[model samples]
Target: MLNGCYLTPPEPKVITITKPVPILPPLYLLNDIALSHPPINTNRELLKFAVKAHNQKVLCNLDKAALRAWRAKYE
Candidate 1:
């Protein structure tokens, strides 16, 4: 009879440090954050929308924590 299990090297322990990320303020509250300046060659409107959405997602606590957890798990 042959052994099914194979000897493998032990996994390394990983240490992660987490920091609080600031949330994005409301549009009306922060006027400058509302506008985005993209390349002249590209579509300005689409870029503006995309930038706003990206900023909001980055500033969200749940979103940031979820992302951090996923990164830690994979890394």
Candidate 2:
């Protein structure tokens, strides 16, 4: 009975918790726009095409800027 009392269980060990790694979101692809062909016929058509092209360019640039911002945040 004395020997059984002396045989005590061992102390519990300390467990260390590690920090989880950050996960990056998947990149989305942009679709290609159907551009107008050159003949352009009249001044009005040319102006319309020019404005549309400019808008598309601006949108593309915005997307690039957003991607850069995301990269900066992750890195």
Pick the lDDT winner. Answer: 2
Q: Which ten residues in a row have the lowest lDDT in candidate 1?
A: 25-34
| Model 1 residue-pair collision total | 0
* Clash-forming residue pairs, model 1: none
For candidate 2, the per-residue lDDT at 69 reads 73
Off by over 4 Å in 1: 1-42, 61-75
In TM-score terms, which candidate is top? 2
lDDT of 2 by residue, 25-64 (tens): 4544433345555778899999988998989978887776
Residue runs of model 2 more than 4 Å from their true location after superposition: 2-38
What does the lDDT read for residue 52 in candidate 1?
Answer: 78
Error of 2 at 33 (Å): 11
Model 2: ten consecutive residues of lowest lDDT = 25-34
Clash count, candidate 2:
0
